[model samples]
Target: MHATTGVGGGLSDEQRIESAAHGLLRDLGRLTRALLRAGEFGLTRSEVSVLDALAAAPLRVTELAAHAGMVQPRVTALLQKLEDRELVTRRRCTTDRRAVETSLTPAGRLLLDQGRQRMATALLSALHTTPIDDCERVVCAAQKSVATLAEAMEPEAT
Candidate 1:
């Protein structure tokens, strides 16, 4: 089993930590699902995932495919679709003769902006209407968890 997975029977400290991590992941999943269900924008999950990833930095098709956990051909097809929609643009990579880097267009950025705002407004209103603690704990814990995960996944120094 994976290290994070719990074994059968009684729980160990590792198992408890794993359980908590799983619960946090589930909560995040629920949050994503609810936001998607709100229907503020009609973007597909894959498109949204691509746009969001590109918002961080420009990436070549192969790099983007790796980042999106998809193969090059699939990502290439999606990039072509996004290109046709004017949601993204591709340019020849300056450093490579045979590679292209994909970046978001003004329209794509605007869509992401509006979609983010709509989701934020809906979530803020919902959370405020409830007696929750403003989601600070969840945000902080998730940030810390992601940082630790990044660190753990990094290659060891030679």
Candidate 2:
């Protein structure tokens, strides 16, 4: 098997860091999709995201769209599918009669729980087979990197 490396043999610190970040992002996307499929929930990634957001609290379609990073029309369509499956319900917003609020049903909550358990089992199984020291190092690095990025991304105080 050929090893994948940065464009050039020698790289600066910034280049190496960028390369590693790209590879990590690619692997994370692949692994997340695999884990989602392993759950066998028959839900698309977008659908799962919608469910996850609703698990927090009921929201209007526009709010759900923002939470899911999707457009309102797309959220409405997904909600239709979820409603057909009896996983979610839409009702007129109590505070705003003009707006509709969507919430997860008991079935949706149960499905989400099962999916989470499956994902946890898969992650635990993978972690069990890996070296503990390496896992700890990587986890620590990831945490630090995420925290740094988040801090950098925060808006400046006026």
Candidate 3:
């Protein structure tokens, strides 16, 4: 916890930062919902989840199922649909011929990238009312935010 300001103030430093972060999350949730509404992406949220998982690296059906919180049978069915659409490909793993690895195809990557661009546009539009006033600061902040999030996503060293 941070101490209150020496002068009379409404919120302490910690409280101010916490509130700002919370507001950012809320706005992001709203932005995501707006982008996802009416199925504009032409992909179900579950299908998108699988693609997102594969964007990191090729994974077997079981690994994808675990990452996406779905059962192996369900993931297999979903993978079949994605593969049929040419959004993903499942091929024999190089290290283990018996195992199949699933990866995002070019089409799948394009869809995800477009969605990200749209979301970024929407988020920047929302920030217009804020005091940012310049694109450079916004870009810097966005980069820092992404770097921080990527760091958080990594496994902690033992």
Candidate 4:
């Protein structure tokens, strides 16, 4: 039986890699949407993206926009909404008075944690039919893949 994936059907290495990448992106979008279905965590995808971006460290509005792949104005609006809910806090930067730094509040962190747990539980239950060894491999590969993408996006330190 022929496998549906293009990663190893006697194609060129580059072609195989590209096909796998396309598949990964397509499935990733579906998975992301599934995780946030109907605002499962009382947070919009954009809002969650912003929160996740801030998880690493506080960021200026421009930095946040870059991280979220959004325009500054839209990100500013989201920040305003988050601030109103006390899920995020923005303050003038100590090093640069003109810049505003945004950080997640404890509430925001807790919400994120809860959302992660929910998704984990849901995926675990849904994967009951899959073999345990396959699940373990997928989980490990996903973590490494995510880290690889994160590193690719980072700029070189000065």
Output the number of the TM-score-best candidate.
4
Sort every candidate by lDDT, greatest first: 4, 2, 3, 1
Instruction: List the candidate 2 regions with Cα displacement exceeding 4 Å.
Output: 1-17, 130-158
Q: What's the best-to-worst order under TM-score?
A: 4, 1, 2, 3
Candidate 1 structure, TM-score to reference? 0.76
TM-score of each: 0.76, 0.74, 0.63, 0.80
Tens digits of per-residue lDDT, candidate 1, 69-117, equal 7889989988998999999999999999699999999998898888888
C-alpha RMSD for every candidate: 4.8, 6.5, 4.8, 5.1
- Give, for candidate 4, the lowest lDDT window spanning 10 residues: 1-10
Worst 10 residues of 3 by lDDT: 149-158
Return the lDDT, model 2, position 45.
96
- The top-ranked prediction according to lDDT is 4
Q: Rate the local accuracy (lDDT) of all candidates.
A: 0.78, 0.83, 0.79, 0.84
Q: Which residue segments of model 3 deviate by more than 4 Å?
A: 1-32, 131-158
lDDT of 2: 0.83
Better of 1 and 2 by TM-score: 1
TM-score of 2: 0.74
What's the lDDT for candidate 3? Answer: 0.79
Root-mean-square deviation of Cα positions for candidate 2 versus the true structure, in angstroms: 6.5
Which candidate model has the greater TM-score, 1 or 4?
4
